[model samples]
Target: MTRRPSLAGRLSRALAACVALALIVMVVASTLVMRSWMLANMDSELHRLSQRAGERLDVEDAPDDEVDTDDDSNEESDDDSDDDSDDDGARTTLQSSGRAPRPGGPLVPGGPKGHGFGGAGIAEGTLQYVSEDGEAAGAVVSNFSVTYLNAPALAILAAVPADGGMHTVRLKGMGTFRVTARVVEGKTVLVGIPMDSIDDVVLMLVGVEIGLSLVVAIAAGFAGRAWVRRELRPLGVVRAAAADIASRDLADESGNLTRVGEETTAGPVEVADVAGALNSMIDAVEDGMERRARSEAKVRQFVADASHELRTPLASVQGYAQLARRDIGEASRTQALERISSEGARMASLVEEMLTLARLDGNRALTCDRVDVIPVILDALSDAHVVAPDHAWELGEAVDAPVLGDESALRQILTNLLANARVHTPAGTRVVVSVLRSRDEAVAASAAPRGPAKGGGSATGAQASSMITIRVADDGPGIPADIRDRVFDRFVRGDSSRTRDGRGSSGLGMSIVESLARAMGGSVRLVDSEKGTVIDVTLPAA
Candidate 1:
């Protein structure tokens, strides 16, 4: 099968075709106009020649002179008679110039007095005289010595009406002529000129037109192709770039997907727009691939961390079960049972936290309701006091702090932050939870270091809207500087060794807190503090 032509090729061909078509139309129209003009000029010349012949015949028919009898009477006087004779001679010479010679008579090469019948210095042409009854009277032929007045030629000439207008006729011995017949002095005079020169001019003109038209068509095709190519150069560059992109693996992290350069993008608005759009599409695809890679990496780490956390609890439970099955005292059996129960609880909690993270990652919608953050913070403090009494837990200056969120998720956020403080720090660490309503602008302008919220949420319009900020700060060895920025990343733990008081912490507490906060159209960030880590949660107010 023949491959279809490219867009550029098609466009070039179309341009060339249009140019050729227009040139052909102009050439044809101009040729026809020129032909008509030449024919009109030839007809006009024939009519003028015929009219001149009629005028000469009319002059010849007039009386030669008044027959100057005064010349004879004055002959004795030399000066007077000489003057009379000169006058008579001048009149006689003028009459003789108009008269036609008799048929079969000795013909003057030029007419009498050196003037031809048509005009002085004119080319010799066909002339014939006919009687009023349509009989040939006489004829003159010069220049071309073709026999005139054969039977067919006489019939054609006799049939011509004695009108002043010219007509076309074909003579048997000759070719074609434009002739005119008119009555002068009671006789028919026929004047004619050959049409060979007019036919030759028209034929020559046609040949030149054909040759020139071909040259112009060829030139137009080549020139049109070049012009179209130059105009579509930018599109060609875009096409090449697209083909190059197609050949490479876009998902390959190491591959550089180059964009259309400025040189190629510059030109007409339409072409530049296409180039710009192509670049934008490439950038978007590259960005999407990077995000996908990061997502995959996070998934892998999450699976590994979850498995490791489960392994510890499973090992402890297994050991306890084996001890319970051994031949031992009732007291020893009871202790092993208690240890197994504790390990089982720990594993269950770890699994629950993992499930919650998965749900949040899936963007599960939560209960959207107005909840007062102060009450949630107080409840979390009470829980923290119960979980770790050795830690000094307190509630800072509180406010209404009404916000839009799921009550359970909001409570979990507070619980996670407070628990993180309790687990990471030693006993007697004062963990304070503060709830307050603040403007977004004030928080943004503050010099305190901030962390980014992790969910797919935007807070661009929140500057003008109200927000409630909750702070869970503690006097503990703050998160290590090395992992501070990545505190909210999944599987990242403050204690890189993943141990706190000989117990394994799941390390997903802070990550869940940030994800939940972002899901509720809010943000969570770690505030810089000299004494301990300060985690701030900002939520849109109800």
Candidate 2:
């Protein structure tokens, strides 16, 4: 399998490719521009030389001075004289510029040969003179041993319209040249300059551009690699941190774990954002892990406690069953049978409560309906009074408190709270069951003395707008201060020794109340009381 490039590597390659492309484009464009300018200048120079050749031919073709007797002849002779004078003047101008007149023409003051206009190596110009009737007049070759009047080159030169504009032609024996033809004195004059110099310059420029482009591309690659690596250093730190975390067993109890610090999370905004997000995720994961561990521990303890609670009743039932099976007298057998039945019923009740808690833990949806909690509280109070008539169970001023909840779950919550109060309190303790239609604020105020209710309903701004609360308060010894916070925890009994009313209490009563209340979109919390425990159940008012 091929190894894919990393972020830094990809970034570096991309940057280097961009730089190389830009340099290539710039170099190509500049070379093209330079070549165009040089070629244009060369053409201009060729045109100038062609124009000079045309002018020189004009001077050479001028008629000579002479006289005639007839009127027509004299007219022609006079015209010839004027032409001769013009030729003399033009030749004198040329001579003044250090160029001698034609081969047989008169000489004028200037420098010697090989020094000025007639000098060798002065210009690589090949001149050809052609007559109007399509015949070559003469040719002049400079800076070379042989004349460039090859048939192919001559044909190309003769094809020009003598328009004084530059054109390009390739001489069979002379490579390429820029040539221009012009009509002068009944003949066409062609002037050309070899293209070797321009070609050489273009070649040299290409070589330089290619060399520079390679150097720049290589340099950019290295620099981009280094810069990209540095810029992405924070990403590497984040990656390492994640990998380190992944390598560790998060389930371990030890809280010592590596975390990315501000230094690594403080770079570029995007990288910083990623680092911050990673840190937050790790923190949340750690928190969740802790909560999960605590939940598991609680579950384990609950199972152990439940087993212990069931074991005693089971043992008693087993002992009584074995005793009943013996040949005892009728009276003794009947008592043993009764004890067996009682122990069996207790164990069944405990098992049922455990099942209920398991169902609640499974997040079973509760029945949603408009329930009048006032009636539920009254019924619970009546039952509690029946169960413990020694305790003064009084019902507070009843109110029509309608709420949305599961009717059975609501009744169960009330039953548990009232039972917990009656069983835990001393005889003659006034156990008050009340129903009140109030807002969250009023409930909070009344519950303030209790330092907030444990496992209480957390209402949204909208839900807290109104609520229905059921209070089960007793005037017996209130819950111990030490266990107040964990009153709703599973298997937590008011008596830490797990004994209540001279028997082992299941310790799941309060836990069941809180779970049922919450499942019904409500909450159960212990309220502060001066004498005895006050349990309040709050639900969203319908």
**lDDT score of residue 116 within candidate 1:** 28
Misplaced by over 4 Å in model 1 are: 6-12, 43-47, 57-196, 223-254, 258-263, 266-282, 389-401, 440-461, 496-504
CA lDDT, candidate 2, residue 88: 28
Tens-place lDDT per residue, model 1, 1-542, is 99988666677667667776787787778777886786677678766766666555432322224111112232244565565542332122222234443222223554442222333333455554344432343233555331234333555677889887768787654667777888877767777777767678767876787677777777776777787778788888899989999888766742478689998778788899999999999888888888888899988988988898888879989999999999999999999999899888888988898999899889888887999877777788898899899999999877775888899999899888888888889889999888776643533311222353334122353562477788888999998988877888777787756555545578888888878887887777876677898888878778
TM-score, every prediction: 0.74, 0.81
Report lDDT (CA) for all predictions: 0.69, 0.68
Per TM-score, the best of the predicted structures is 2
Worst 10-residue stretch by lDDT in candidate 1?
A: 66-75
- After superposition, the stretches of candidate 2 with alpha carbons farther than 4 Å from their true spots are 5-7, 58-122, 126-131, 137-148, 438-463, 496-504
Per-residue lDDT of model 2, residues 200-225, tens digit only? 98889888988988888888888999
